[model samples]
Target chain A: MSLDFGLIIEQMPDILSGLWVTLWIWVVASILGAALGFLVAAARRYGPAPLDWLLKLYVEILRGNPFLIQLFLLYFGGPFIGLRLEPIPAGLIGLTIYASAYFSEIFRAGFQAVPRGHVEAAQCVGLSRSQILRRILLPEMTMLVLPQCVNMAIILIKETAILSIITVPEMTMVIGAIGSQQYAFVDAMFLLAIFYWVLVEICDWLGRRAEAKLSKFRFAVT
Target chain B: MSFKLFELMLWAAGYTVVLSAISIVIGLTIGLCVCAAKLARSRALSIPATVFISFFRGVPLLVQLLLIYNLLPAIGISVPSVVAAVIGLSLCTAAYQAENLRGGFNSVPKGLLEAADMVGLSPWQQLKRIRAPIALRLTLPALVNEAILILKASSLISVVGVIELTRMAQNLSASTYRPLLFYSVAGGLYLVICWTVAGGGALAERLTRTSRA
Candidate 1:
């Protein structure tokens, strides 16, 4: 059977509302993940040798697997460890940890991107270590990592779809519910695809804008 | 976890690798065709190729998997779970691989094509003798990166009822009341597979490093 465009139009508002759930999860998860990642990167960069190696192992374990499996571990598996979480929180935690893994690596690369000579020069100016990190390293690393972070954000947004599998009632879940209920699988799936396409396109546009703005600032500084 | 549970996870992990391996090879073939289409001077071919790349790369693979699994039957073409999963992963990876190969092909030096022309090489000869080797070399690292990404993403196939590694872990964990052990073991198995893929990539990179021409 052919698609009923009128039904799709009627369901636009219900479907579009999933957009907020998606954005909320993405923004909250990214902020939380990036914060945790910053700490981990700092530790990896400046902590004791053994701590750094341990941190590296943590990053590798998370990075080497799929976020869906990570979500399962935190959601289905968490209660075994005396943790019982609902879907949203379980998904939020899982997404955060997953994002943090990649973010830690991105941040480490950002840290490395800062030339050693610059940090040494800051130290030579009699600035304290914390002062050097705050005034010199953080700013530089933010610029270096902004584009990569946005890219990760895009990936994470796409990943938020997986949260629906854990019954998060997010976009994909809502779409599936509506589609199956009305026997409009084709229309529903196409609509879902389009919605995600628009979202990803916006993300990519924002990424380009941030890159442009950051590069302009870097040029001015130099 | 018990040995039986561990064995089950390993069995499912085998499914994961086999499925991903099938998708990567199939996707690579599709990607090469799409790359060739987009590279051609004809807008007729390139426009649809560009749209395919944008659509596949733009949508999330989970959604794609669900659509393939569900929509095919809606249209009276009911495929198996494995077929649907493979289609989803293959098309999704094909888009990314096409772009990577396009980049590799674009980076092939113009001077080499000109040199081939000067040597009286035909178009096919130029492609075989100069362009293919250089582009493949340039894109080898990207191919490896895509392979790892696919291996990890193959986990999503579970939603479509393919009892792959992660799904196997879930089933075993639910029955055994040992999420921690099964998941950790599953994670370790995934890491080993990924590490091997990455190690192979590194080895491939090293082997190709000395070949400049």
Candidate 2:
């Protein structure tokens, strides 16, 4: 109930450093996740019968388990298996894998959303498969993918808080350390919540802009 | 893993499922009310609902858990870790379920309500016959989705000292020095539980469809 803004201001440097860590994790997770997702999505879309089942199983396993457990498995289990990893790398790998599962679904849906007729039309016009994919499919899929990717970006930002449970020096952990040290429990938590809120709101705003652009794409197509 | 170890994991996962189910049920009830408020004509009723949904949705559940765990001491209400965990999960899930319910209800056509009104149906009858069923049906898939997410998220309750499945896995692995075995068991348990939930949801949907038909 008693919030001291001055206390928060005093702890600003620590909080800012925590924010920096969170930002880098978010960016790396997004890039790595998106890369893995595109690969999985492409394989799922184009690969033959047996590979479909294997790829689907990979996606299912990741989706079914919680991110925290995944992190524990990597952070703790990796060393046992000779793949020794630091906390930062373990956290990053865990998040990237988790994000890829969710992102792959989005990417798959984006691919599916592209109209089949357009691809057929491109083929009829003598465009090669890769050319058609680049020109027609990629453009249309980007319209759908951008907004969803933005959404996943927001989710990933919030999820980085979970990394703190594994001792990843993120904002949430920093806020906790500050809160208990200064007994500004309420103030520290309030600030932490606001930090996450602003991050998500920015992502949401960008998503809306992308969504608007998508509608314009559709408008132009029509 | 040994049989005893696997059994321990199963037992821990059972706790995970029970905690998640309790919270999900409570969240569904709370979500119904919040959804009702969000749909209400009165701004006074709707504004608080909006705030609740926004605050809960905007903040990550992990932070919420930590905050609530700490908040109880400040408020002179000392609850056990399990209680704190459930409260955190329930409130957080309620926010999401509320949004899901709102989305469901919003999909109910205005024309349908107008028709009900023209037929002189009372508010209660209209809600019972038209609004509730349509909304629940619309919300079925989302409800299932949220349930699975909460089940997975229940892992975070370990931070509050509930020692749920994931925490149990962490401890067992750290102690036994067989991280691979314990973590794999934990992952398998989660996957099993999730699929069961998903299968049940699919069954319920099918049953409803057949009964209607």
Candidate 3:
């Protein structure tokens, strides 16, 4: 089959719209997941024994299964429990939950990397818990966690493609729909790959820049 | 869920495990070659390996699967769904595994290699005794982590029509109107399989540590 730029040009508007949906999903899910994940990490670190066990189980089960299965369960299986949702909402929730499990682990590692003596020292100086968190923990973690969190952002961006499976009309879904109609499957597939690759490369660049800036700040502080 | 339906899911779960196992094995083999190429002195070898790792690692596996499934037909080499699935998974994992291997090898101490050289060890002997063993030990955990990632990723092969665990769950749920039941069962099956693999990896790590000591 001949390669066709004309077809992709014709579908540019649809492709752009699809890309927008992908960006929206990726941004919202990443932010929400990171926020929720930070709390989960903190709770697991300092929460009660039973609560820690429950969160551990939650994290393990989510991490173990595929995101596809989790999405299906939430979208298709939710109706059984009288919690039906539109495909996009279900996808957003599913992705947020999936991302939190991973993000929490990253945060947990960041927390662990900080020396316990620092927290103890802050406490001895009559620092409040929030003060210690702000003055001691957050600064120490800023550099360590930024890179992994950015990596997670890239992963979440890639995962937005999977939302197409549940009919979210993202870039992949648009490509699939147009390809079937135009019979330019190969070109469509390549175009889809380029879209994702560009997104990932941008994230990688941004992550590197942020890490550099943070490292400078870290050095300045010390 | 009915016993019959559960049995079908169990069979499908078996397929998932087998598919992931085969792909990981093939991927690891390809990974070694790519890793070697990446570590080679020549630009020609290293450049292509770098591009391969970047493309596979950057693109989502779903896109890769779709591209392979369709591109094969366009190139007049139409493959079955299972073949396409395996090819997609293997190539994708190979890239990640190559990076992991490169990291492991890079971590091998320069002093240790120099010591081997001083002992009159040939290059091949140094590779076999000093480099390979240290890299393997350093990378064992990452390898197991990749294996589990591949196992979870294998679920995406269902998109190409391979009736593995997730796809089987979908079909059963669609037919029986028991999405919750079947989906939960599928998730549980995946959890058990992943945990077992992880446990085995831990055990292997322990054995290797003792042997090394």
The candidate that wins on DockQ is: 3
Error of 2 at A49 (Å): 2.2
Report, in order, each candidate's fnat. Answer: 0.74, 0.73, 0.87
Share of reference contacts kept by candidate 2: 0.73
Tens-digit lDDT string for candidate 2 (B1-213): 788988888899999999999999999999889988998999999999998997888789999898898888877899998999999999999999999999988888888889999999998999899888988998898999999999999999988889889889888987999888888889999999999999999998887762231
* DockQ, all candidates in order: 0.71, 0.72, 0.86
Per-residue C-alpha lDDT of model 2 across residues A158-213, encoded as one tens digit per residue: 89999998888989988888888988887788889888887877778888987986
Ranking by lDDT: 3, 1, 2
Error of model 1, residue A31, in angstroms? 1.6
Candidate 1, residue A218: CA error in Å?
A: 5.5
Question: Which ranges of candidate 2 are over 4 A from the true structure?
Answer: A219-222, B210-213
Say which candidate scores most in lDDT: 3
User: Which wins on TM-score, candidate 1 or candidate 3?
Assistant: 3
Tens digit per residue, CA lDDT, model 3, A119-200: 9999999999999989899989877899999999998888888999999988999988998899888898898898788889
Each candidate: what lDDT?
Answer: 0.89, 0.89, 0.92
Task: Estimate, for each residue in B181-205, the C-alpha lDDT of model 3 and write its tens digit.
Answer: 9999999999999999999999999
What clash pairs does model 2 have?
A: none
Q: What is the TM-score of each candidate against the true structure?
A: 0.92, 0.95, 0.97
